[model samples]
Target: MTPPLAVDIDGTLTDSNRALDPRVLDPIREWPEPVVVATGKALPYPVGLCEFLGIPVRVIAENGGAVYLADDDELEFHGDREAAQRVVEEYRELGHEVGYGKVDFTNRWRETELAVNLDQPLEPLKELAAAHGMHVFDTGYAYHVTSPGVDKGEGLRAVCDRLGVGIEEFAVVGDSENDAAAFELAGTAVAVANADETAKAAADHVTEGSYGDGFLEALDSLRDA
Candidate 1:
């Protein structure tokens, strides 16, 4: 079997506005192997989107803090949940906008990481997280606070193990600083035209288009490979 395709959501599958092109769904579902939706978004949103698109696949949510397999409909958390929660409280105490409770409805379903709206600069947040022995990642959509060792690369590695695939057989598509780890893990790392410099620099191929168009371009390349 072909290695699975792991893709980031915010700036890869969807545009800046979080709008997915309907055209990408059919091809994705028709792909030869599994299509894992790896993202910084919470589990529900990605799982819901996959359902609506009629695409059955596993999901790596909360920026590698959790994994949800659609077949079994189970969520397996990978990060230190208590530590993630503590970081949220710490961020809140530090006067950052950390979304918990009803602060951000879109972020309500997350369990292992804290998602902060992009109302402030991320460098300070990263610094603060480091002070607390945590890590902060900017996903172009939000800032994710996770345990120091957690990242999308780990999530993809887990997915590969569960599916009996190897990292060298996988193709990863992403467009943010948070995507750097997974890009490093993939045999073929593709960055959309709109990708942040760090992500692009980590990629093996940079697409000419942004969002879904870029994803489609990468998918074509992978198929032709």
Candidate 2:
């Protein structure tokens, strides 16, 4: 049996603008290689894709900071809650503005992390963080403020640790900066053809197509391997 292959849903699997090829998901469900959708998108995106693809189960949401097993309706969240709360409280203490969504949905510490929704741009956020002795991390959508160091890379590492799978056994696929870590973690890092240049550069290989077709490309790569 093949180890789990962690895949990204949005640009790597299906283009929200276009429908996914149901044929692709068939291999994932029937083949020995089990697939896990690792996406930076929120719960809704992964859930919808899973439903549309008839994948009833699969997906690591919020860039692997949270994992949801649709088949079991169970969630395993990552992140240090106490640490995140301390950071949030610190932000409050410092009077820095912050914005977040889906926070109260789960009280678990490991599932939630400190995310700074940027009202402006990263340069300003970096300047502010540097002035405050805080670290600013990039995640494509936001300039994340963290205690010292934390991001999707660490989150992907955690998932691999829990699953007891090594990089040699799995393929990590994604289409954004957050996906960078998983790219390094898994043996083969697959980036969608539509992925930004930065992402493509970091990837071990670029998919032949976009979204749905890109997934097929990665699947082909898997078969070739």
Candidate 3:
């Protein structure tokens, strides 16, 4: 059997305009194995995608700060919500916009991270996290302030266990720094053509196409592997 597949959403499976390319949906419907939508977006977005594809899949949301199993409608969180809320307050006081009102509807449901779209340098955010006993990560779209222990890698590991598969049986695809740890854990680490330098450096393979096209290519290769 082909191993379970894990993929990032934004900048990997979605187009530059943040729209899901319809081309990728049918292939997902026919996939013989479990597909995990590993993303930083909230649960509802990915759940809606799975529904549109007419397939059952797992979700690792909040940048691995939380995991949601579609079958069970269960949620497993890894970060401290109180600390995350405090980080949001700190960022707002520092004159940076933070929270759902500033970003989107998903921000209101976020439990473990505060995502900000300040478009500022990340170093200062990292410094702020240090003071709050937290960690900061960039997902190519926004700055995420989260608990130091929460990440996509941890989420992937949890998903692997739930699926009763090992990391070596998995092929992971992503396009940013938050995906680095997951890349390290997968048997085949693939980066899309437009992936960040760090993510490309960590991958075993880099697809020629970008976004959904790249993900389709990677999934085809994994199915044949």
Q: TM-score for each prediction?
A: 0.90, 0.67, 0.92
lDDT, candidate 2, 1-225, per-residue tens: 345677766566567464555766777676565567676555566666767666655667655566766445667765454554555555655556455545633222334454566564456555555555556555545554544434455555655565556656777777777677677767778888877776787789997788777877777777777
Model 2 bad stretches (over 4 Å): 1-3, 16-24, 43-48, 51-58, 68-75, 80-119, 129-149
| lDDT on C-alpha atoms for all candidate structures | 0.81, 0.63, 0.82
Ranking by lDDT: 3, 1, 2
What C-alpha lDDT, on a 0 to 100 scale, does residue 73 get in candidate 3?
A: 68
Tell me the lDDT of candidate 3.
0.82
The total of clashing pairs for model 1 equals 0
Question: Candidate 1 residues 204-223, lDDT tens each?
Answer: 99999899999999889888
User: Roughly what TM-score does model 2 have, to 2 decimal places?
Assistant: 0.67
* Pairs of residues at least 3 apart in sequence or in different chains that clash in candidate 3: none
lDDT for each residue of candidate 3 in 1-225, tens digit (9 for 90 to 100): 577788888889889887877888787778787888888887677777877778885888888988877667678989887886786677667876653464377577777787776465577677778898998887778888889878888998988877678988888899998888899898889999988998999999999999999989988888788
Q: Candidate 3: how many backbone clashes?
A: 0
Off by over 4 Å in 1: 1-3, 71-74, 99-103, 121-124
Clashing pairs in 2: 77-110, 77-111, 78-110, 78-111, 79-110
Give me the displacement of residue 136 in model 2, in angstroms.
5.0
Q: Clashes in model 1: which pairs?
A: none
